[model samples]
Target: MSKVVLVTGASSGIGKAIATFLSEKGYKVYGTSRNPKNIEDFNFKLIALDVLNIETITTAIASIIKLEGKIDILVNNAGIGVTGPIEETPTDEMRNAFNTNFFGAIDVIKTVLPHMRKQKSGLIINTTSIAGYMGLPFRGIYSSSKGALELVTEAIRMEVKRYGIDLVNVAPGDFATDIISRRYHTPLFDDSVYKENYKANLDLMDAHVDTGKNPIEMAEKVYKIIHTKNPKIHYKVGGFLEKFSIVLKRILPDTWFEKLLMNHYKL
Candidate 1:
């Protein structure tokens, strides 16, 4: 029997790639997105889903369950990014980020866990980011949301271990996704306060994202993990820069790390 997999945020980027790749791998895959009309004749089924809407999530899961009978894998890949200084960011923006990045994942997980618990065998992969580990300037809001997701994944892993379920967190460093290209609704900052510094920081983030890894690379990593017999709790995917960042955080003192980041970003 083919393993059944459900992936969220399947319209594009890593999520879409994962859905396509997994379907090609012979898994009975179902991909969800807010706009499902664009997907047609794909290897997997595309269902309309808005992570922020609990009703939509519940209905989608119910529909999938009716046909598949069992879900073997669930990938929480739906998320958004918000950039700017923490002080400058608005409360609503912070809430929106957390709603989609953290709460949305939680909502789907809660809906799927019951079936997985009954079956006693399943895998849940949460798409976190390197931002979850290291907070970057100008992107603190997005980073904080991912950081919350990291902790949530950790807790879920522990809770679900005894149920014969595997929970994995895929933390990709700066992937080349349309996320950066999309216009962000950032908070308006006071022009008089650190105007030049803020503009420079935003520019640096834009340039960094423009040169990040391809989304397919991240999708391939997700494909590999799904098929592994013994998957680790966390997997990091990226180039040398990602590894270097992790090492720097590990070996360097807090003050030194801050200095390095400041110099790197020219903040």
Candidate 2:
């Protein structure tokens, strides 16, 4: 029997790429979107899901398990981004970001753990980003939420090791995806000090993503991860500068690294 895989936020972008790749490769794959009707053009099975909705998650997982009898892979790829000055960013937007990016992943994991533990074999891939590595100038909330997710993935790895479950955080650097259009910016006030700077910074950020690696690159990485017997705890995907930035963070002095980022964004 083929391995059964479930990926969240599969309606478009990276999630869709992964689901399509895996399905074509013969794995039984299910892709998720809040509106199932929207995924009809996709190759894999479509499952309606709103990660923020516990009931939706519960029903989606149950429906998958009922058909496949097991979930060998769970990809937490559903997330939303909020951009702008952290201080001016509304509390609700920040909460929505965390709710969708962090807690949604947590909820899905909680729901799937029991089944995976019973089977005693599974892979859980959490799609994070380069932003998680450092706080950006205008995209503080989105970066911070992914940073929280990074920590959550780390802590859960140790807890799930004995259960034969492999958890990895895939931090892709600015992949081209629908997330660009879907991104939510904190309300920008014209009279605010951050208005002009935030506009420029947000545009630069979008340009980076618009020109970044394609989703297929990350999808290919996920395929390799699935085939490997022992995958790394973290997989960084993207071009030289983006992936290398993580290396620099590790070896460079804190002040130097901080200044580099600040200067890059003209903060």
Candidate 2 per-residue lDDT, tens place, 35-84, comes to 88855598898988899999999999999999989999999999998897
Worst 10 residues of 1 by lDDT: 183-192
TM-scores, one per candidate? 0.95, 0.97
lDDT of 1 by residue, 182-265 (tens): 536464456637567778877766776788888888778988898799899888888787767988898999999999888987
Off by over 4 Å in 2: none
- Poorly placed runs, candidate 1 (over 4 Å): 181-192
lDDT of candidates 1 onward, in order: 0.86, 0.90
